[model samples]
Target chain A: MTEQIAWIAVDWGTSNLRAWGIGPAGAVVATAGSDQGMGKLAPQEFPAALMAVANQLALPDEPVDVVICGMAGARQGWLEAPYLEAPTDLIALGQGAVHPNMPDERLRVSILPGVCQREGGENVMRGEETQLLGLAVTAPTYAGLVCMPGTHSKWARLEGTRIAGFSTAMTGELFELLKTHSVLRHSLAGDVNGPERDGGFLAGAQDGLDEPEKLLGQLFEVRASALLSGRTPDWCAGYLSGLLIGTEIAANRNQIGTDPVPLIGSATLCALYARVLAMTGAAGRVVDSTEVVLAGLKAARASIA
Target chain B: MTEQIAWIAVDWGTSNLRAWGIGPAGAVVATAGSDQGMGKLAPQEFPAALMAVANQLALPDEPVDVVICGMAGARQGWLEAPYLEAPTDLIALGQGAVHPNMPDERLRVSILPGVCQREGGENVMRGEETQLLGLAVTAPTYAGLVCMPGTHSKWARLEGTRIAGFSTAMTGELFELLKTHSVLRHSLAGDVNGPERDGGFLAGAQDGLDEPEKLLGQLFEVRASALLSGRTPDWCAGYLSGLLIGTEIAANRNQIGTDPVPLIGSATLCALYARVLAMTGAAGRVVDSTEVVLAGLKAARASIA
Candidate 1:
């Protein structure tokens, strides 16, 4: 007999959506995804978008539990899911999940709420909370600083499964803007390989780590170095990347302890962050973002069950 | 008789070109400007673009001296006027001026050289050098820090008529990019006036000044503040402006001594910088940029007279 599907898990972000059908034993039985992300769909369109992915899986006769995460629960998304305040336990995430009104009787849907910090400074995260929950499930005793590198990189302090506080740095976004739109665009062309790339990266990283306060002043040097000294575009690009990442690390240096920080993100980006962290006399380990998010969804499913 | 144009002064920048016809008494006899800046013209096209403005003034039978400054001297501009290393006397700027081949015998164009600093870091200034020279000509005893706020805000250390060194911050450019392209774009809207605008600006300025190192981390707070606490777009815009200006001031705090900084730029921008400078316990006085550029051009003309 074919393995009976237990439930459905969906990670609906701004640009894309991914869904998985889990079997009774918590193993993925089927997988599907679409470009129909939260950004594209209206409140009424969300049901159809989800069904497009869900229809791929073999649905049982009865209505199956469907847990959704990310921007799908935002105020502008399918249904508004109010944020749970920070210092919230990972285990308690499922209890806060809000049920969106489902049109089809075959689907029982619940969207997980995001987390927000209000005391120190205003901050919010929709999708990352689930990943943090997954991290907790995968490693029950792990607790310290966690760095999730992306466009808006987040650095969170965790106490066991609870997120104490977190801050975001717009490093990746700024790098993209500077590379594509700013005056440094021309200076940041071409590609370099091997030791030269490493050298350039290290030099810029060192500058950023040592004197982040001088960042605004140092940015023009990229263009000047190219114009005056004819520095290659590849070196400039590498240097810019290292500078932004290094500055991000330096900004959060106060929270990073001697313990090895778990960097959760794509391998390439996490690797860059790890290298910069090592340069600052700190250790970092890569944690696959996909694995954690899935584990977090599973944990949430179990909480509701 | 019609006032014979003694010479012409042109500030050919990236986006716009402005020309003035000087009388023998050193007063402006005629003025003209166009969108045909250095960025749009080719090597051969420079003559016609210059004439567009020059033709407006009364011309004599002989070729008239046309002293040009700004990006017109850039490598990509009409003619490449090599940068004179910093600490060179401002009065000697005319000596380094290069003359591009002119098709019109009625115009003898000389583009003034910009200043470059290579000892500490790579830095080059084109048009602003003329203004600095103008400042030197107007106030011969002035020797201190000069702040010029624009798209690329410049802070230079001056000794008499010499520019000792200078650094640039892309504060204004970054602000525009963030407001138009970043996620915070939605949050930074509305028209704030009076005390509300000042309050927002001061609050953001204080944060930026107090914790410049955390700038990267603090940027997302703009979006968060709007998302969580419902900040008005006007306030957000004002805050962003304050934050950037404050951060710029903080970075250059070392160069800013007890001496009052002479801010050279548009009156509106200079006022903002002056306010931020005051907040840092430093004083700033506005100097009209146009007056200085004209004076500097006149000085260059006199040197070659």
Candidate 2:
């Protein structure tokens, strides 16, 4: 038998593009990605990019419904999907128009809308709708604290599939600032323990979890006093690592109310956040975001199917 | 009529060397500076840098007792003066060298000692001993928090001429890292503000101070939400201002512990920090560092005179 038509799922974002080809049974057969992220391209350019990737699987004219999420469906993405302000459903993440430039004979696509949030007066999240969907789909039991950490960290309080409340933390940028430009630079020396996750980083994160409020002033002091008074740079890095993670712990301490915190990210990042939160005497479970992203993509795909 | 010597003072800092010659009553007779900074030259080079400035004054080696301060007295300065651990004194700050190179020559130089500190477990400061002196001399009998804002901000508890305790905050570098490298950068356009103090900077600082504690999380939202929701770059700058100054407010909330907070800096930086703190119903005062540095230099000279 010849290779059959397959389902297409994608998680297009700011700096990256990821797509998957799934069989009728929902198992992924092939996948592709590129540096051509939505943030770099205009909203109209996404169709051509998606089609370029779709052509890779020799997709036949039998209309392949592209169930796209992430930043690809943002206002600046392939289609202008308006934000669905929380209390969402497939109805909330609505379907937008197909590519006006592409021929009807080549493809049929549906871009997913993102979610908006307003809690404690006003707060919002757009592209994270899918990531939240992925988390909710993968572990319906993941009801407490779910955090997706990266350059922009999103912490959500999930009560089942419905998101109760959420917040974002810019821990990644703070880490970069201290290392390169601040007085703390003298203390960092740009080199630290192996893989950045040796016992030192974990131990430091634990330190943050314990005392978040008093750590900001402490963060700069570690690197500063070290360089001035002859302290090691590695300890400085570990100290800074503690400060940023510690600040996040303080910011999220309240939202993580009641249930244990579950961290979702790549193994290394998850361990770093989890281990640090653990140090605060708060138990945490690390989950894989890739799995959640895939599960989220599958959920979006099923909706279109 | 020959130009007569009045007072001799110096801004003998780490990397910038400046000295002034005044009429007998401390009016500028001649001013000089050179690349021959304490940071650039060895202990032996301090004499040459001093001479380079003195030669510019065209003065004979009279009984002019020159007062020097800043990094020139550090372990690596013109004379290796050790830091006086806190609960410091003018004597401690006055323990610098008399220029072993010229004390016997009737030419005099008194190097000032830096202050050391360990508060909230451990954090110390040097060089600020002079700035703290500057603050006290300029705004004597003024009680409340005095913030000397810079790359590393020193928040001091100044009581008359004595520096009781102080804390350092890395607000500047943190601003750079977030604006240039963080996801938040996507939200910030390339302008720090339109120009000088007339621009949107103060507006941004005001918004930041409005929600000081929620700063870290809101930072990520500015970028991530902007990418998905289309928030402007200007707000990103404001968010950055908010994160940094907001952290400062929380870090220095003790400023309003009993009395009003006094801000010490150039008019611009002090105004910004003052406005942010003002939002919390606290009073503020801005004093010029130029005057403080000069007055600090003068006090240092008379103590050895």
Candidate 3:
């Protein structure tokens, strides 16, 4: 019954879980995802949850060769795979795997290791490892800065198949904290997106990156001026967005180190990052790295085959 | 009744509404506080909510003098008292009271203004304004730095009876967010206190304040290291506490202007701030500001009386 086994690939992130079923040639057959993100799932429950998705593909309980990526490989997940330090390369990933609850009856499952950063000091990245691998493949013709921007924006320096180094900025998370928890929330109007919104976000981002020293002090004005002087809440969001992302852009202008950085992520997300990057006079091209995740998944599956 | 009317005091904060029937000598004859804090009550409900407490004293409904100093007068409170700007004196406070539902109600209620700051760029402080006022009164000779520590740590500079400037750090809120919402919660062991545990709080605080340039980049390590390394979860609090307090301390080191900052707050809270302060070679003194809040309440009440 071994007619060259099909491919199994999964992307397990903090808030999302995506799985794909591919033919022998890495052609997509079926795909599935659920709100059962790694952040919310119980340790022992990952197997059953995975099987539920496999069932959706009608692939039965037989665990062909499944390769997983993201935070799922952290100590809290199915296994405690350590991160590879920066100046990391593809071969630096080594062979990492997590034996889930259904292990005895399982066919095969391998979880990828994330990156452990120790430049100025210690830092980490889990799911981005897979994204980087995908990035390397997708950007093969292109060699420069490959960035995956999200809650923690990641920038990877890749040459050929090797990931030279990577850095992260808590841009999105800071934005969330400032908006929801900080006093800045009071000044910001609820919605950040609308039609009458006269291009406030990019402008805010520009101003933020320009003057970071004034960042912490100006936070009050965003709210006060909005309340007292009637600044739009959208502007507040844009201003805050600017402060976080702009601070990141300014601080890492050297680490990211390039004239043009290729932003590789979902369309909307890449746009957001690109907008911030635009302020630095950095050239940016939005590339969809989704194919790379699937490609990396296929490559990982092929290794076992 | 008139003779006993020494000081009518109130601690009208966010989640709890409290009023004390103080004698001319500032002694509590009757104390009443309700779940009817500003957070729980609507703007229109302030009259009835406050009246419910005053009714307990059998005090006349039409006119009674009270000096309130708490979250009650915050922007989110029943009445939005204007924020007192930095480098401000008590005289700089906003005029007019938060006329409760009762339009002509003469139960003279003077809600103090929260502090407004424009340092570096952010604005913060509310409940601390009253405490700062109390500190000036109680520590008549005390000057330099006064830190009112809590979920949000407020660092203020008091030049005699006047407040020069202050800043609010989201240190406490960070602790809560990381412990409850972030990945750190999973491997977390315990608090930053106890004989077996000083936790990592002090160390974290020191680390945070150590260097301002590298502050934001180092935040993720607190959680990541605690999980991957032998760092305890209880230390997570300290690590976070250090980052926040440390950052504030470093940023305001100039504003604190090379002087031993004395912490003025409740005994327990003062100790915590002092412990962190000690690590920085900055001496600290705990002044029981509860009495000062009462005193400030008294003085405020006397003015209207």
Collision pairs in model 1: A134-A296, B189-B233
Q: lDDT for model 2, please.
A: 0.66
The DockQ of each candidate is: 0.79, 0.43, 0.22
Candidate 3 overall lDDT versus native? 0.66
TM-score of chain A of each: 0.95, 0.86, 0.88
Over A1-305, each residue of candidate 1 has an lDDT whose tens digit, in order, gives 55688899999999999998999888988889999999898999999899889998878889999999999999999998899898778788888888888899899999998999998777899889899989887887888889999998988888878998888899889999998889999897666443466777887898889888878878888888889988888778878888888888998887888888999988999999999999999999899898888898888876663
| Candidate 1 interface RMSD after superposing interface residues | 0.9
lDDT per residue, candidate 2, B56-163, as tens digits? Answer: 876755667677767787666777666666665543355543454652353466776666675444555555667677777776876556787776677877777777
Rank order by TM-score, top first?
1, 2, 3
Name the candidate that leads on DockQ. Answer: 1
Which wins on DockQ, candidate 1 or candidate 2?
1
* TM-score of the B chain in each candidate versus the native B chain: 0.96, 0.82, 0.83
Error of 1 at A146 (Å): 0.8
Question: How does each model score on TM-score?
Answer: 0.96, 0.85, 0.80
Model 2 in CAPRI terms: which quality? acceptable
Output the chain A TM-score of model 1: 0.95
**Residue B69 C-alpha lDDT in model 2:** 69
